[model samples]
Target: MNENFKLLNKKIKILHLIQHMKIGGGQKALTNIISSTSISFEHVVVSTFNQYESELNKLNSSFIDCEKKNILKIIREEAPDIIHYHWWPGFKMIPKNKIPHNCGIIVTVQDPTPVEDIQADIYISGSNFINLFQKHIDGKKRIVIKSYIDVREFTLKKKKNTEIIIGRHSTIYKNKIPENYIKTLLDFSLKAKFIIAGDGESKIIEKLNLEIIKNNAQNKIEIWPGEKIKEMLSICDIFLYITPDDSFEGFANVISEAMVAGIPVIAENKGGNSEQIIHGKTGFLCTGYNEARDFCQLLIEDRILRLKMGGNSKKRGLTFDHTIMGKQYDQIYTNLVKLNNKEKQ
Candidate 1:
């Protein structure tokens, strides 16, 4: 830890209110923040759902399972210096009058357009798109804090593979997958192996599998569980991500993770995807599937180009390192506490 970071270690207690501890971008982001932040700050994570209780225990902070206890009771019991909500639904219905006067409320907007009516002392957005979208909200200090991950965990020694691999991983919602997703994979099936990893609705999974079978691409495309994200990234040479034209991503963590693993990405030029990829340098952003296919084919044919872009991608990905994000968050928490104390006095 830097000596400057230690100055902000005032043992401030932060109570994180989240919807669940599931394996999603928001949950992972929260865990990374808790793990990377200075140990001087105390953390207590309160989850409305307890699907992955074991994962919550892995964090350095304490955990509160709201399934078994009341959130209001837990908040009063913790009486933290800061009450930080990870997403909108987490703090939606909580009464403002019930909270302690000295406690500061911080809401990190994980989605592009979250419910703006929710009151908070500070509103943190993960991307500029979200920050700008919510700029009209009244009476709150808004700031942009990009999401981060533990870059060290993604650093993997590459091994030689028989075929060029293109991969993408996500929670796999209908809107998250492009409409012509199967056709796009079939186009590249002869040249590269495709790996789509993630858990989603059974209907979506069934539809994807049926399409693969219908197109006789069962052997070319492989669908893996979301838990094997690290393994998938290690074997993949290129990261290809595409979502529907109408759908938008707040800040796709998978793209950053793939980049950190030294994989060049070719993502759809929509939402925050444009912000993550530096076109023609780190990776190419496509306006449509045809453009994405061209970019993917370009990298597939030129191994040297792939390596060069991958190196650039890794360099750019380091900007979202956990330590850097942790420092920024530490400063934010420190400032909020100071402001709250001044008002209280």
Candidate 2:
């Protein structure tokens, strides 16, 4: 048997270190990876903040509460063949000398900003735009492994009502919910029902609510808690996403989720949104709120065009499915382990 095949026959253990198990892009990415990876691989997730105990149980993997115990102690005890760090803030605090040399280190860059004070054998980015920032990180290899979603979970269903539902889902940070985007949604408030779903800072939520009230568009625009994303996408005819001119999305997993759910996406032409959306095909990428409004109106007016774009979106979205992501990670793990073993000899 080939050396690589021999290593693959045995179980490969991956220890995932994350800042928190909270409901966010990074946590969701980790969940998709763990759930989709091959049975030949075993996963153990460690959360630094120890939030979401119930969510961790669903992963079907061993969990370590970092708040209760030292991470180095857990690392030594688990002795993972590969240590994968998501976001990597948790790894910054750990002493480099304490980490076992035998295990390979992989860091997934979840944010657009360049990371510092962290060393890894491999650095994985979610998009080409993010990979540009990771060029500064010295690694054996820097690769783009786009964030993924489980497509089976998203259902492509027919719209039940004539009401045009425009939706956007995110963490609801102030920068994410831009004042200009809010104005754009208000522009079409009468033609469509807008739903902005996600939990975030209370002050930001209040500010949005106040804007809706000031415009007297509360009935037209709804602010929902960020749960049941599939249900949200199922009802929405179009997924309209916008951030401030300055702020940029790393990958926008919500856009991919909406695309797979068979909804046309109208996102800002910034950051990784350009990569996820194909202009005028899978969806439209707008330079400003005016272009977004124009695209939104076009989709709302033409049902056939909307469905056609949606169909295209689903076809393109499957390319980022979690299974594909798992295979890529599996290859990375196998190659790294093989290389590490060779170095030992």
Candidate 3:
């Protein structure tokens, strides 16, 4: 639909509530959604915590940084058609009676667990694998919509023939990498260059540094603060997505980003990673460190297989476009509004 036509219609006012607009999967996903959505939808972001200036300024919608006590007041005053809550913290902050019964409540599930006892008209999940594990949500409308990116921007870069670059980008605090996993990565550092990118507590970084030093793999292992991820993925030949046993990664956006950059991934067979990796095709899903090690080594040793898998990854990654994702959510919003109107009549 044309922008002018969309503008002429009665726009559905959306109050998107999240904990913070930090550099994370859910935050970026919401940003992509609002930016790609048609002008017919009016989006207002309400964050309980602080937001990154760059990310907050990027959106065209109005943003509100409010205290817990004021959140319900803002919602009631704004009287938005849809309350699209993302984070668990955001869900907890909602007061029961503040929202009018006719208002549509939609909760976007980004973690393995949804907020218990929260009343929502629709529950939006980012992956089918994550949705399968959801037990907290009852009798709510469920829809699976995977995270998306503009795959075109992350073009494939020809990796160095002599050196294979293995990269992993994540908030390390949530990652519960076993000591044995570190040893396994160090073992791979013997043949390939390893890059661990992401900012975390100083203690965690120091611990990782100590592990690298103890293994005498400092030359091959590079641990640094996270930068533009696409830049990191461009030179990377393979990606390592090993999270702890109890990881709550609803949809691993980093895995999708790496795939878009034509990099093969080897992820732990848990969380939303199952939905992203095509096991043995686009990438491998391993059950343990041993399995992960074998897959990593295979990609490192076989150049032809690496290229083939990378191509397949890109092909699969292209299927997840942000524009398409926005349209799907738009349809859900439209239906919810119609349902609300019908109930009133």
Best prediction by lDDT: 1
lDDT of 3: 0.76
TM-score, one value per model: 0.91, 0.90, 0.88
- Per-prediction RMSD in angstroms? 2.6, 2.6, 2.9
Model 3: lowest-lDDT 10 consecutive positions: 88-97
Model 1: lDDT of residue 224: 86
- Clashing residue pairs, backbone N/CA/C < 3 A, model 1: none
- What candidate 2 gets wrong by more than 4 Å, as runs, is 1-9, 49-52, 88-98, 138-140, 180-184, 188-190
Model 2 Cα displacement at 344 (Å)?
Answer: 2.7
Which stretches of candidate 1 lie above 4 Å from their native place? 1-10, 89-95, 98-101, 138-140, 188-190
lDDT of each: 0.81, 0.81, 0.76
- Tens-digit lDDT track of model 2 for 161-210: 66989988988876677765556677754488998888877888888888
Worst 10 residues of 1 by lDDT: 88-97
| Candidate 2 local Cα displacement, residue 179, angstroms | 3.6
